[model samples]
Target: MARIAFILLCHKDPKAIIRQAEQLTAVGDYISIHFDARAPKDAYAMIRDALADNSNVTFARKRIRCGWGEWSLVQATLHAVEAAVEAFPRATHFYMVSGDCMAIKSAQYAHAVLDADDVDYIESFDFFESDWIKTGMKEERLIYRHWFNERNQKTLFYRSWWLQRRLGLERSVPADLQVMIGSQWWCLRRRTIEWILDFTRKRRDVMRFFRTTWIPDETFFQTLVRHLVPEPEIRTRTLTFLMFTDYGMPVTFYNDHYDLLLSQDYLFARKISPEAGQLKERLGRLYASDRTDFKISDEGRKLFQFLTGRGRIGRRFAPRFWETETSLGRERELMIIACKKWHVAKRLVGSIKHHTNLTAIDYLFNEEDTPLPDLGGIQTTLEKRTRHRRALMRMLFDYHETDRLIFCIDTANLDLMQDFFSDRSTTRLLEIACEFTDEYLAGHAKRVGLAGEETSDETLKQLLPTIRYDVVFEADRIRDAGFPNHGKIRERNTPEENAARIAEFLSVPEDTARSIAQTPYLFAD
Candidate 1:
């Protein structure tokens, strides 16, 4: 039921613009274009002639020489809005978009959502009240006059600001208006658009003030709408899916991003590549489809956010094993228990399995008696096993679906200990202390393929704390030997006391810890 009047601000790619106009016209919407005056006249003529047969499309008569961060862009937008208002008489809303934008959702989907309310879809926030400006030109943008193009005339632009600062030539905004800033793309009610147009006609002084303001297109309508409509009637978000680069340019979509585009809940996406024919074709079909419900998968949303650099990049364990990239990002936890004696480490893991909900496994990194028998390919040789120890642990981390896992390794895997400690969200470590004789140390070094490596108690003592760990359980004898604690060392004591310490370290209940300590396997020796 909602009739939308789309005003496209175009500068380049006439063929692509023609195709987009056709798509919008086919969707039962009105189209108006305000081609840049500085762009090639031939390009504008081509677009006009191509869409001449369509009664739904119209071009603005007045075109302004638009420039990035200059007043001309806002002037062109005003001209387009005027043209759209006169052309589409029954338009419920006036939606402004760039020529490079493509429809991500069907027109009916947008109409269904907008027809539910008379609310204005625009992002408007007070400039001084919010950290809206990311380029560090927050207040100065409105306080100074900018005549030079920021994108093409960088030298003159910066020099103008510098000279103005030196001379202390600062301008004041109108006292009646509180300056607002937001995204340029907006879908505003037709009544709201008319009110803005009327205000611009009467308020010549306010128009002049914004004439020299930097990027006034982003601020002019944003500031006016706040004054015309009540705050409750406006939704402070854009319907267009836009992602900007660190340098402040829109990220252009290509052919490979078709699936990504489908996953978006937005109606449209901005700044697509002009030559992306396959992407355009697929999205055009999406617009023509009768699918009503638009829902996005959580996995897809997270991946898209990560792709745009707005979300964290998750760690992948064995990427080759799966068709898509999978990351164990805080989904499951990995706790590695390491000690010199395998028997003692096994006993501790047994106790944990006896009490907690953790999936505990003994000697995961062992050569012959590994808990994971399927790891034969990864642990074929001692050298390869030593080299791929980190990968092995991460594979285990990814393989298990449990909320928490406790696995046992030996001090021989100390070189790769730091890798497990890097992502503290999913990994923790527990080290139990034991005496290593000269023969035992030599055998350990030879077994782990580090025969000639510095393998002594002093070397081991110096290396343990340097590699970060969650907890270290040791008797007072090791403490007297000047082993640097790094606040992770725990004094070995009675089984019940040890359980209490482990319980506190793992943040489990004291009762649970006592139950683990009372296990026959833990206190047998």
Candidate 2:
């Protein structure tokens, strides 16, 4: 019977904010909102009037003019938490989120996740030991006083820092306390929140030190919580889904990214576009629905890995050389099946399936099942689709458990061929040459009245040499019967001996390799 009290820090979008409050209140949870003092008075009034009838909603007593990388953001959050705690004393836990944040899953799912553990969910890592902050200032954020707003007053902010550096001016933190850093978002138990609030009220000197520290919101509670709560009671991970761009701005989710968002295991996601009305509505319905089967799909994980993990700029080389350099996670291993015809792919897939534990996905580049009509135009749609497919291929390589994978691709989907071969570290490829000679291919293209085939053929021919692979199956030699699926696959090898060529390359079990070699496989177009 764990009850959660939500504290939302909102500035604008009164309508969206009202809807968010309504959705949370409808499910028996209490929410407190802190509207920024700088926002229009009418926006704040509208949000208040909309939630006037709901007893579960309340507004903070004071609204602070919050700024990015400033102390006021944490002050606003504190006001919201104070209001929520005072209003709802029985609340077991407190969840802090921004106005644009939405519930990706049901409320019960969150309760279920939290009820199993009495630990606090907040990202707290040693500021000195951990490389939590990705780019820009690091230890300098704490050492030098950051008086100007980093976002609005970029020039003054830098100038102040330079002046401080030139003068050799450095601030001293409390010797007893170790600084910590993490994402500002968190879900903490009431006891933890109460302890943090109490600690802040009593420790004026420590608070004064943090007020001048850069991005205090990310460090304040993170450092204080570690001081108040025991290590065993704390779980250093944020329950919120937060992804940042290379420039360190949080990624804004749009309507077209619905599928990608659904693929994550996070309970809530933030920084949604204000214009994403459709996405907001759909997620609302999903939150209210009694659906229990929430799963993280392979496609979703792959998309996440691509966007946040492997696809990030400069990540590929940094972590390999620098011990302090960090990455999202490991990329998966991949193997590709490039075939001339569908039947040849089918034969190879079946042989591999019979021999190994690997699962072969047939025609992965087929048209996407869901239509993204809102994304606009044919070109835009194609671009999004291509991006998603690339993410999928990358995700597959990161699936570390199953090392071997077979995917079927024909000349029709040559658009994705280059993308699949982009990452060389985790990819093992096999190619199946066309059965027909160049002259025969040209004649066939003419007879079929399909000129596009000639273009695709040339594209494949030119692309194949540039791509790296472990083996290639000659169409001429494989035309005869009794072709072994496993054997020694060298640059110079005859097809006279029935062999398990791919199995040999993959080094599968001997018994499985024998089964693959002995199996009579027929290839059709």
Candidate 3:
């Protein structure tokens, strides 16, 4: 009865994302993806393709910098919550995730945690009480003091001891203390959102001050909820669980193995890297009663559909000027950069599928010995799946000559399941999607999207702003933006190595038809 909502944030890494999405999708849940407003259209589109099977995931409209200590990041999150809650009012809890983040447990396990009628799965850090959160607040104050004195950014931190509170990031309720907590990346109830938003509208002053604070998100959310809520329902620990790393990439993971992380009793985490292929199976173990080494059903399929209804996806929301404003980009323009198969991509995809014209899909790695053709199942070969998951993700994200598109996934999906295609939909309508003949989609009667996403909504000009983008990233680089920060670029292989490649990658000539410098969406003069 408790509907699960996964909020997946995308920056780079397509193949890894798809694999993880598929795995997560196997478990039914509401899914939504918040591509960094600045992420390339192609990069965003590739993520869409990965969720083609389901009809709940949709692209978000808010485009703000998701820096570690900026109001812009908090703004993006609040806005994203606004969109998701509007679409899935019935949703019981929302899980904040990153492009690289993955669920070590099955959706069911998580569902149980959230669905447990008695316990409210709210991931909050009562800053007033939390030592870690208090540290962050102290850090904010110290930094602001230094910045104000040296940098003269005094007006920014003028309010109180908690700089984030004064900067408009925190809710100034009861008193003016800024509510601080984990980066708002956690599982929470629908009521919590309603209360927070309402709190914001009422306390405009406190909210306004947070806009200039250092770690707005962490400080703001924690401070507000702790102050407002009675008896503090949040887990005091830092995180509930985690993948190999909070940073999105590809690697191995297991719910049991990561139990220590989960032991924190916290609900959210940041860095994560999991083999795309094993997502469903690995995650399944976390919740489902069924246990096996590798199987898709374990991924959370039944739960996925329960959260994101197919009918919701068919109804199109008015497209923003920006989506149509930019030129249709070149094919394969988004490919050759970023990998996927990380994080449980399904939950995010499911959320988006609900609001878009894009078609949601569940692409299972077809292997022998499974009972059903389109049911949930994980991969028999984890190693090979991981290697190929990335390769195939490139194919999905990269544009081809004919369609000149990365595989276009349609219909906003609540979540995309990767483990195994379900034998059939629980409902009758999902069986017949616009282009798909599958029983589940057909029964749902959801509209499918483009043959594929040829061009992305965002142009090359805007491609940062999701997470601490300025930080040294070991991910891809834009060879040229056709402007000031343009041309002859080299790409960093990993997020950790991103900064080092900046100078070299930016200088590679694009005119040469071919160069180490890869082409982003070619811009119009």
TM-score of each: 0.63, 0.63, 0.44
Can you write out model 3's per-residue Cα lDDT over 1-525, one digit (the tens) per residue? 667667776666777666555555555566666667666878767777767666666556676645445576678777777777877777787767776565544454556556554333434554455564422245444234222321244454454445554664533333546455554555667787788889889988777666655666666666666666664466543333432222333233333324322323333334443543343344434543332222111112221232233224331223334332332333322101111211112322233234323333332232223222221222345333333342333333332222211121211211121100111211111111111123322222221221112212221112112111311121222111112212222222332232223223222223322321122311101
lDDT of 1 by residue, 107-191 (tens): 8887888998779988888889987887568788888888888788889989999999999999889998998889999999999
lDDT of each: 0.71, 0.69, 0.42
lDDT of 2: 0.69
Worst 10 residues of 1 by lDDT: 482-491
Off by over 4 Å in 2: 256-260, 297-301, 307-525
In candidate 2, where is summed lDDT lowest over 10 consecutive residues?
315-324
**Which regions of candidate 3 fall more than 4 Å away from where they truly are?**
49-53, 117-130, 133-178, 237-239, 242-270, 274-281, 284-525
TM-score of 1: 0.63
Clashes of each: 0, 12, 157
lDDT for 443 in candidate 2 is 41
